[model samples]
Target chain A: MKIAVLGSGNGGCAVAADFALKGHDVYLFDFEEFNENINAIMKNGGIFVDGDFVGFAEIKYAGHDIEKVITGADLIMVVRPAFGTKLFAEAAKGYIQKGQKIVICPGSCGGSLIFKKGLGLELEDESIIVSETSTLPYACRVIAAGKVHIYIKLLGGIYLAAIPSRLTENVLIDLKEVYPGIVPAKNVLQTTLQNGNPVIHPAVTLLNAALVEREKGDFYFYEEGVTPSVGRLMEAVDKERIEIGKKLEIEIIPNPVLGLIQGYMQESNYDTGYSKGRGFKGIKAQSKLDNRYMNEDVGYGLVFMSELGKQIEVETPIMDSIINIASVIMGKEYREMKSRTPETLGLSSYTVDELINVL
Target chain B: MKIAVLGSGNGGCAVAADFALKGHDVYLFDFEEFNENINAIMKNGGIFVDGDFVGFAEIKYAGHDIEKVITGADLIMVVRPAFGTKLFAEAAKGYIQKGQKIVICPGSCGGSLIFKKGLGLELEDESIIVSETSTLPYACRVIAAGKVHIYIKLLGGIYLAAIPSRLTENVLIDLKEVYPGIVPAKNVLQTTLQNGNPVIHPAVTLLNAALVEREKGDFYFYEEGVTPSVGRLMEAVDKERIEIGKKLEIEIIPNPVLGLIQGYMQESNYDTGYSKGRGFKGIKAQSKLDNRYMNEDVGYGLVFMSELGKQIEVETPIMDSIINIASVIMGKEYREMKSRTPETLGLSSYTVDELINVL
Candidate 1:
């Protein structure tokens, strides 16, 4: 399989290395501003993976040229945060090949929609298969310049769905070879709603905003930051997400159960699961509240969900609240800025059934 | 002057004692559930004032009888939080005399409106004068039963406004004798808009939520919790508040300036002022995120401002965000459960000018 991974952040590096080690021709590309990781990998001639997936993977191509990375690529993974979604899509506009599969790893709320819009492609365009996963498959981080630490390779329950609702199966069939845990979701709506990033990250990060700013990532975020009361807030937000799913007639996994499946928790309850769970044992809080945990999850993910809730007539007070708090903390208007919604996806005029059919 | 002080919380105790020492016939009342302070005062036959105001102040009356407190009282002050605005109004309804002046010290965002609704009185009702102050004058706390440690008495900049635009002068004249810092505002809109509590408390408390929950109020709130980034958020919310005031043609002192006026902060900028302010020194953060900072301030204060902004077609994104975040953390629909707005105040149908007139 020929794969092009966009962005060389922690997730991007992990994906590129894992694929390259599996003997797939992997091309990793990042913008000039984000070329540090890829430049390090290029200099090192390979990426060293530790923890669950331990190996050195030699990437076939590593550069800033979007055309060089996308040309003739069988699968293109948009692995950047929501902040970079549009930029990557814009870069991939003229270069995206026909019949190529595009996957937004950990879509970070409406990634597919944002990408589709950015690509200037119609929502119903079927020339290229576009899919998004609920979250990234590997709970990994960059330990060094060129070395990535793969914490937990999710054994099961990584959800994948395609825009226009038809291309999910084919995309899943190919990607499942690398991520056996990946499963086909009903639609992009399912994949979007199933995203627990917006549910957990922003709330947890904002709840511990001052501490994160104070400690500079000194403590385990999940273990120390998420107390009983904070746990209750996470549950309330999770309930709102589930309620939105019910309204949309989409089957979504609850947060705790999903956390267990995603290898983020041992318990199927918020407090015990997040605080004591081995899956999140070594995960440190973001050094600042302005990181992707907020910018991506709250700014894009929660904003998208809130917009979706407005479209579906389901009140997402908790999601709105998180987006609101994140926007203030980040000094940006998230809802007014980039957000994935029915309107943005060109499904604003569609009824719930019609919208479901289209997605 | 015969004054009846309602609610036995920190502010209420301070008000009761201050007025009593100033030779006013002060009647302090609390519900049975909150009668502990008054009971202690009754037992002590006075309130022990320590800090800025130092001495024992004899109370003419101290009990749970609302009638005993309201009867023959020239002035009635509701110093409870916004949470008790309605209950206090209900308690003071029939007992309130025709010529008596009622003041909600530090109205906590639309307290005058909420009080009017609870009292079932028209905004135009001039037989009795109703007024609200931008904030409580003294930043004090009760060290023990019937004992309060006064921090700083505000020298100036406590805004006072009446329900109708007409009654502000008389209310200000009387309140000035007790709270010399009290100055006449344009209307209740000025008083409500001038409130910096909703701006500072909810953001700071929510930002430092996990730390507060974990440490149980061990650290000084402003000095430790209001980091540079968190201070930026406070400034952003303050901007939205200032915008609301502009839209309504009401003059609002910026949060930092208001803080200086209310004696909570000395510096004019958020970071330098809050982190280093003598007024905010030694103030402890709430032990939990569910306290009045989130509950009263975000739930009522921000909600009211957002609603007003919506009515006037002014955007209050930051205020809306704070309210939303606070609501989720507190596990309640603050906008629905408790909020002071045009509709809640029965002024929903009024135009901007009419609303201004009524307020």
Candidate 2:
């Protein structure tokens, strides 16, 4: 399989490295950050796969120069955060070759939908299999400029059903060799609702702000910070998310449990378990620096969730409160911004069928 | 003449000393935390007073106990930050002699009402004349345990208004001898509406929390922190206050103009002319350990003002927004607290005629 990765950050580089190591032609396409990593790889021509180590193997191409690297690629994975995703999608729109797969590594539930919308590509626009993973593999980072460190790439979570579902088999066939862990869910609605960031990040961050601001030592995010008071707030937000998920019948997991399933804890519920902050089990979490969680997750993830909750007649006081608080804390007025709402995400008034078709 | 000072803090101690210095019979009551100062004052005789260099003379009477303090006093001023006034008022209820004057030194806008209501006294409770001043007499603090350090005795911006206008002249005769600066207003409405704390505190604190948290080093409370954004928030609050004042037919001066009238500056409005950062000359800037504007002003004063605005059908979105925002920042659900709303203050259900009669 010939593959290329967009974004050289934790998620992007890991995808590129993993595929290249698998004896497949893999290319990493980022803006310019992949250069030193590419340079180091050019010398050794192999990525360091440590955790569950496979072996060092050669990747053919890794560079910021997207066009030259993306040429003749079977699959192109864009791993940028939500903020840069739109811009990267626009660039890819012009470069996409027919039959190529542009899988948004964990389209983060809504990334595929967001890209599709941003490209002005409607539900009918069909040329490529634009897919998403539930989460990226490799809770990983670059140990040095050229080195890739792997931390047990998330083994299983819900990815997306191809927009038409007719293309699901094709998407799975192309990426399964690279990520055997990918599991297909119904649509973007299922994918997005499964977004754990909105459910986790804002709840953890808002509850632990004082601790983060004061001592700022690593906090057991679920155990120490999510007190009963904070838990009630989370439950309120979760109720809204769960209500939306049930309406869509996506089987969304509660946040702390999701962390457990993701191999972060020994237990799955807030009452008993501990989340050792964002670094999943201190195993080098694969999440981006300031990407999907704040933007797509909370931005698209929570926003759409809240909007849908409102549509389905669910009260989301805690969710709205947290979103508004984050907005102010971030020095932005999110209430007036459309980017975080269902209306903006093309889900506000859509019938589920319309949404599924659109996604 | 006999006078009892209910609270032995800066305002209370200063009031006790000022009257005792004039050779009037005076007594001061406070908690035993002031054991050292009280013993010293008992030995040294009374509070130290000064004019222009003919200064620091101990006057008379260190009546540390309540029974000893209230004995034979013609007038007793309940001087405390709205917190202790209720307890002190209830304590005084048992000891207050018939027809004695109880003047609330700087009665917070609703203090007289709270006091009267606490005693189960009727609106026409005229035996004890309740009055309030716009502010305390001296720019002071109790530096030591019992002794107050007076910086400047403000002889201006003081308004005294009795509960029943009938008792106005009777209260003034004694007040004149003690204050020599009391400018009588029509009633408690004028005095209460003249509060400057609510107008200044919320705007400064809410907008400057980051600065306050970042640099506790030499930050001016007034001049530096009250920026344009603070001014806008304050102006909104001030307009609400003035609208309430207008509805009640009292001209409560806005903050900037009040500063000018108090001889601080010649600024007319809060928008531009009044510069913050440098602070009022000779008056110690209110840079307390924590910016207490949230608790002291917003919680106490703005709650009063916001409620009053509600009674008058005045729109106070900005004021409401600040109060709500500050309450969240403080981690309290203050918005739903009725004591925060005008209805709890008896103004919500009051007819225009009833308010006039109560005042």
Per-candidate Cα lDDT values, in order, are 0.83, 0.64
lDDT of 2 by residue, B146-248 (tens): 5676655654667787776657778878888756767887677777778787777666655445334334424655555444445555676777788878877
- lDDT tens per residue, model 1, B1-359: 98899988999989999888889999999989987788899999889999877999999888999999999888889998887988999988889879888899888877887887688888778888888998898888998998998887777888888878678887778777778777889888888889888888877887888888888988889888988768888888888888888877887789888777667676788887998887777888886666888877877788888888888888987777676666666768888874677677676787887766656
* Highest DockQ model number: 1
Tens digits of lDDT, candidate 1, A9-63: 9899999998898899999999998877888888888798998879899987788
Give the native contact fraction of candidate 1. Answer: 0.76
Docking tier of model 1: it is: medium
Candidate 1 lDDT at B321 equals 66
**What residue pairs clash in candidate 2, if any at all?**
A106-A133, A109-A191, A109-A192, A138-A153, B223-B276, B223-B277, B224-B277
Listed in order, the DockQ scores are 0.51, 0.07
Worst 10 residues of 1 chain B by lDDT: B321-330
Q: After superposition, how far is residue A136 of candidate 1 from its true place, in Å?
A: 1.5
